[model samples]
Target: MSFDYEKYIRPGKLPHIWCPGCGHGIVMKGLIRAMDALGMKKNNTAIVSGIGCASRLPGYIDCCTLHTTHGRAVAFATGIKMAKPEMQVLCVGGDGDGVAIGGNHFIHACRRNINITYLIMNNNIYGMTGGQFSPTTPTGAKASTTPYGNPDPPFDIAKLAIGAGATFVARGTAYHANQIEKLLVEAIRHKGFSVVEILDSCPTTYGRRNRFRSVVEMMNNLKEIAVSVQAAEHMSPEQMQGKVLTGVLYRDNRPEYVEEYQKVIEAAQDFAG
Candidate 1:
């Protein structure tokens, strides 16, 4: 079967706000392709986003989109999913939105195992907010706010999601276009809470401040520093110190919160009888 993206893209929004070398565009394409492959109905799907360049995804998609307050997309999406379980709810946001201001919501949503897909664009800095350090920024990565080099360790997003009770967790990068799309399709199809961390580039903020020279150089570094699960297990402390994991790091079958809630309602009626 063939799918037409033009039909689902909002008109007059062709010129995106991201920088020339930004990776959000690649991630967006992956998502659109995955939805099309899954044959998701645009009307039946809802895209929720928080404040950030990545959050603008909802505005570009031709669907029931909600560009909500900063770091609150997950919370808002939770309500929407509970009210309408059949909706194909997807949340998009940046590292700052998902793991900094919204960190609490991110973990709780995973623990609740709400049936929703969260695509976190982890560009390592707050690109939309002037290149500030985020929860996912490396310990030594330079940012506008971290002039003398960062002092805090970055959060491994996939590991956090897995530990927080996300039934499905995956990691991909803008360079791995095909893998991202495939993973997104599986994430959306998963019956429990799913999280995919897409490592992206911020040419203007992170690139310039960190001496990346260009977006292509940043991507090359990403490819070189990334490690697979199997490779990570064999690496020593020195080798693993600066490494990042990619691919489907973890997944499992768990009872979803919404499905369990319905069961409770059914049990209550039986007890009343």
Candidate 2:
């Protein structure tokens, strides 16, 4: 069945700012498709984003969206979820926005197991910020700041989220569009903190510096390196090198923070009575 994506897009926000051949558009489409499949009402959903190329997504979405300050989208989303626990809050951000300056907030949100979905577009560079290297930028990859090569090792967003106590964690790539949509649906439905790290391409910035001939080349590279979780288990460590495992990496049904807090409040009232 064909989905009328226009219903979820802000008509006046056409002509998005993402560069040609950028993978952010594909990720956005997956998000919209997942929401549509789940029958999510725009009014009941709140999309939040921080500053960066990927953060611009909320502007184009027709739902209740918050384009927040750089590295603060997660904090703002946490507040929204706490204030209205019933609202389905989704936070979108880029590699830099989510794991660089926002690193503290990101980890805490996972530790608390907040009932919110966080989609991190890991394009490996800060495309909007003059193509600087980001936390997820692979070690030895050239960027605006690292003209020679980045000396710092990259952070695996999925590993970080899982280690930080996220209840659900998964990964997907722009090349696997259908998988991205399915992962988003699962993340959104998870009751506790859920993080989906999307390996996206920034052809204009990251690709140009990394020697990708075209956006298609970058996407094909992602497809080549992507392995399913089940397949990865059968592969040796050497075989897994440089390969991104896609699919649910971790999941646990811990008590969601908001619901647990509510229990505390009720218990206190009962004690007073």
Candidate 3:
């Protein structure tokens, strides 16, 4: 049977505001499928996001959703996870919302090994708020703010997450729709801070400025540049220079922050006694 996506979506939230050829819709559908695969109930799941094109995802899902200010999604989601550790907490946002203004929160959450999943949809440009250049916008890429070319170095989000001590880190792309759900399911199942950086497309802003002929070209670029983690091991560094590795990138066994904090509470109680 075809996937019943309507059951997971909110009533009357149809017809999203995203522009045509946008991949945010695809990512949202994948998240729903992932939730279904895990048998997660709407009451038991809390999806949070910040201000951006991708941040609008939580508003459409039929779950406990928190839509916060720009770059505050992870900070808000962290608090939610700490209070209700049993709930499946997910933080969703675009590249700028995740790593630009919220970079500190993102790294600290990873360092604390908080048991929350963050899905960073990197479309290279800040598609919302006038299509400015974001932290993930590649060097030499053009944007509304950078008409000549962007001089800033782009961030490799997966590498940044791993370096910041996120216990589970993985990557997928809009072109690989089949793999997105699998990656999300694995990230949600992990016991510590988990991050899934999905390279998505923003054809309306990024493509138009960067001279991409169409959304198909952008999607095809993703397909051509992505190399699976397993497939990358066999290739030489030269062959992998321009390729991005997909799949689960790194995982480590770490003490989750919420469980550790509980110990502190117990210690305080015992001291009072």
Candidate 4:
């Protein structure tokens, strides 16, 4: 059955600002499908984003949305979650916005195990900022700032989230639209902090600089390199080189911050009584 995506999108916001062939639109559609599948009420859900091309998504979504300062989406989302623990809060950001300038808040949110979901659009370059190499940009990849090719090693966002103590961590690509939606639904249902890293393509910026013939070529590359976690288990290390392991990377049952704080409040009331 076809989903009514218009129900979730703001009507006047049609003809979004993203460039033609940009993968951000696919990621946004996946998110909308996930919300529909979960039957999330717009009134009870909040979307937050920082300054970037990908952050513009909230402007098109029909929900309580916050367009925050650069690299501050997580901080603002944290305040919203604390103020209304019953509401579903989601933070959307680009690779540079979340993993570079906002790296501190990102890890702390994971360590605290807050009941919030973070969807990071990792396109490997600062698409809105002249195509500079981002934290997740592959080593030796050409970018506006690295015309000679980037020499720095890129950070694996999934590994970083797991190391920072996120309760749930997963990876998906824009090429796998259905899988992205499924992973998002599970992430939203998880009790503690959840991070879903989406490997999206910025055809206008990253693709042109990387010598991709077209958006289809870039997408095909993603499909070729992305391997499910289960399939990866059967491959040798040498064979796994240059492959991106997708699917749920890690998960654990941990005490969420809001629930733990409520316990303290209950204990204090009991003592007073």
Error of 3 at 148 (Å): 1.1
lDDT of 1 by residue, 1-273 (tens): 565778779999888888898999999999999998899999999999999999998899999999999999999999999999989999999999998899999999999999999999999999987899998888988998899999999898888999999999999898887888998999999999999999998989998988898788988977887887778888898998867788888889989999999999899999999
Superposition error at 123 for model 3 (Å): 0.2
Q: Which stretches of candidate 3 lie over 4 Å from their true place?
A: none
How well does model 2 score by local distance difference test?
0.95
Clashing pairs in 3: none
lDDT agreement with native, every candidate = 0.91, 0.95, 0.93, 0.95
For model 4, what is the error of residue 117's alpha carbon versus the real structure, in angstroms, after optimal superposition? 0.6
Could you give candidate 4's per-residue lDDT for residues 1-273 as a string of tens digits? Answer: 677999999988989989998889999999999999999999999999998999999999999999999999989999999989999999998999999998999999999999999999999999997799999999999999999999999999999999999999999999999999999999999999999999999999899989999999999999999999999999999999989999999999999999998999999999999
Choose 1 or 4, whichever is better by TM-score: 4
User: In model 4, how many backbone clashes occur?
Assistant: 0
Task: Candidate 1: count the clashes.
Answer: 0
Candidate 1 minimal-lDDT segment of 10 residues: 1-10
lDDT of 4: 0.95
> Per-residue lDDT for 1-273 in model 2, tens only?
678999999998978999998889999999999999899999999999999999999999999999999999999999999999989999998999999999999999999999999999999999987799999889999999999999999999999999999999999999999999999999999999999999999998899999999988999999999999999989999999889899999999999999999999999999999
- Measured by TM-score, how close is model 2 to the native structure? 0.98
lDDT per residue, candidate 3, 111-215, as tens digits?
999999999999988898878999999999999988889999999999999999999999999999989999999999999999999999998889988889999
